[model samples]
Target: MLPTLAQTTALIRHRRSIKPQDLNPARGVERELVVELIENATWAPNHGVTEPWRFHVFQDEARHELVREMERAYREVTPAAEFREDKLQKIGTNPLLAPVVIACVMERHGGAKIPSIEETEALACALQNLMLSATAAGLGSYWSSPPLLDGATFRAFLNLGPEDRCAGLIYIGWPREGLNWPRSARAPVAEKIVWRAAAGA
Candidate 1:
């Protein structure tokens, strides 16, 4: 179910990360709703329609394959002596915690007029759109990059190329009761924004 405009704003402002265990077990989001959220995400501003965003969604039975690949990658990277049995167990368990795991990949377009950094920033905006849309849809989402960035195992699992970079991993699921937290306070807008006039001219 979608929220009203004011409710949507409130949802976005209050949305917080719920631990995997705190996600509702029986309330997986429908596939159509996921598609809708992604469609809305595309409305974000893009510099040249390069549209470098790519999403690989892992869900239902397909999540098993993703988990298997993640474990394989983890083993490849973990040194024999340093590897902890529990760490491997956690890796195997991570993806199943969410109803949907979205791989947010930034693809490089040939002959891009702007720098690669600009392309990545544009993708970030798209991700924000996705997060907000999920909130409005009564779902909880967490944007994570630790596993995608530091885990060489994760890189191999995704088959990332030289030019391809991971922007984040999005985990979406229904929130358990009392799982939502209040928003963190921000610095004053006056302190963050500045107006420059030429010596009061």
Candidate 2:
């Protein structure tokens, strides 16, 4: 179900990045809620009715393969001097902590009627929708795009074409810790808004 405006705003304000380790293993989110979240995500505004978003969901045993791929990519990019075995292990283990990992992708429509940049902006809005839905559903989510996994290698692994772009990875699970972070302050609305009038009208 969709949250009311006030409730949605509150969720947005309270959302924070809960670490993978900080998530509760026994308190996984149900598949039904995940479907609801994706449904809500589709409500985001898209210019010219181009629904460019695609998702690759990873959970349970699938997560192990993802971690293995990510570890391989990480090792390939990391400098040998700075690479620690423990850190690599942690990197591989982190994804397993989350019950689900959502790979958000943008499927580009070549020769799109709308501007290309607007399509990307629309995808950003969809991403926010997903995040807000997660919050409203009582699931903690962290959106991340590691540099090593941002290129063709990752896209190929996920079976994305030349036009498809990897937006980010949404890590979803139950929060182990309470929502305790202070809300980030926003810029003054007056400074951002302006009005124009005819001269001497």
Top-scoring candidate (lDDT): 2
Deviation (Å) of 103 in candidate 2: 0.5
lDDT for each residue of candidate 2 in 89-173, tens digit (9 for 90 to 100): 8878888888888888887763547776776677889888888888767778888877656655676788877777777788899
Least well predicted 10-residue stretch by lDDT in candidate 1: 146-155
In the predicted model 1, the residue pairs found to clash are: 73-153
Clash count (model 2, backbone only): 0
| Per-candidate TM-score against the hidden true structure | 0.82, 0.84
Write model 1 residue lDDT over 1-201, tens digit each, in one string: 866889767766776765556667567889999998888777877778888778889988777887787677667766789777897787677678888888887776635577778778878988889888887777888887644244666665667776767787788888877764536777887998878889959
Deviation from native of the Cα of residue 122 in model 2, angstroms: 1.7
- Off by more than 4 A, model 1: 1-9, 77-87, 110-112, 147-153, 180-183
Question: Candidate 2 local accuracy as lDDT?
Answer: 0.79
Q: Which ten residues in a row have the lowest lDDT in candidate 2?
A: 177-186
**What TM-score does structure 2 among the candidates reach?**
0.84
